[model samples]
Target: MELALIRHGQTDWNLDERVQGRTDIPLNETGREQARTAAELIRADGADWDLILSSPLQRARETAEIIAEATAVPFGGVVDGLIEQNFGEGEGMVVAEFYDRWPNRDFPGGEHDDELGARGVRTLDEIVGAHPSGTRVLAVSHGSLIRGTIARLMRTPYKQVPRLDNTSISLFAHDEDWRVVTIGGVSVAEAIPTTV
Candidate 1:
């Protein structure tokens, strides 16, 4: 199985560097353009995607719809597990301020990092299991979820996973196990250290 993971387009919260975790923000005009660009890039890659899936959040769902229209691929509906991690008290706060106030990066009542990572893995497993052996799927999700998923798949520390840009693409392949191919268009061997 092969999968392409894409971060949803930018929202106003993203522009202001505010935490948008589970806030249900919509995409800005620029974000819609970014989604179109992502579709063009995928078309240029010459891969015929079987289908596209996305988180239930408006930003991600809209992005997936745009990509599906542009690529002529079917939209496979929302996967709840693809939802962004809840930031709890950190939602709507400027990212820098939130980190400054909570240096340890823990937000009160927020979802734990381990839980997010596990969810990421489980979601991918479910997707793969539901499809045929050679299925190629495109999934639109949040930055943190994508990062956590990649970290868990690579068996690397979450902090070591590089941040993903809005609409950035990462590819993964599965045989007996999952492995990262490229992240944000950079090859894993070039951009990530596989071992701790």
Candidate 2:
């Protein structure tokens, strides 16, 4: 199985550096353009995608729609357990301020790290098992969820996994063992720091 994990495009919350966990924020205009560019890149690569799945969030769904339209890949139904981690009262808080205030934990009622890891792993493993052998899939998800999923798959700390940019593709290849071909659509050997 060859899985392409894409982060959803930018939103107003992203531009404002707000914590958008579980907030149904829509994509900004620039986000649509970014999605189009990402779709073009995938098309140029000649990826023969068998499925295109996305988080149910409006932003991720829209981005997936754009990719599906651009690549002519049939968009798959929304997969459960791929939503962003809930931040509770921190949803609209500025990221920096939220971190400063919490220092150690998320907002009250927010999800825990263990829960993040379990959900990410269970959902992805289910995806891998449910799809046919040698399936080539594209899954559009949130930044934190993608990061948590990657960390769980690699058996590393979530913070150790490099952050992915908006519309960036992370390839997960499953052979006898599952491994990552790329972290953000580029060889993991070459690193870049980017934000949505």
TM-score for each candidate, following the candidate numbering? 0.96, 0.91
Top model number, TM-score: 1
Taking the candidates one at a time, how many backbone clashes does each contain?
0, 0
What C-alpha lDDT, on a 0 to 100 scale, does residue 1 get in candidate 2? 88
- The parts of candidate 1 lying over 4 Å away from their true place are 193-196
Candidate lDDT (C-alpha), each: 0.91, 0.84
Model 2 segments more than 4 A misplaced = 191-196
Worst 10 residues of 2 by lDDT: 187-196
lDDT tens readout by residue for model 2, 72-161: 999987987778888877789998898898876556878866678778777777789888898898988988887777777766677767
Candidate 1, residue 58: lDDT: 98
Report the C-alpha lDDT of model 1 over 1-196, residue by residue, as the tens digit.
9998899999999999999999999999999999999999988889889999999999999999999999998999999999998888998999999889977667898886777889998999999998898989999999989888888888777777888899999998999988888887788876685552
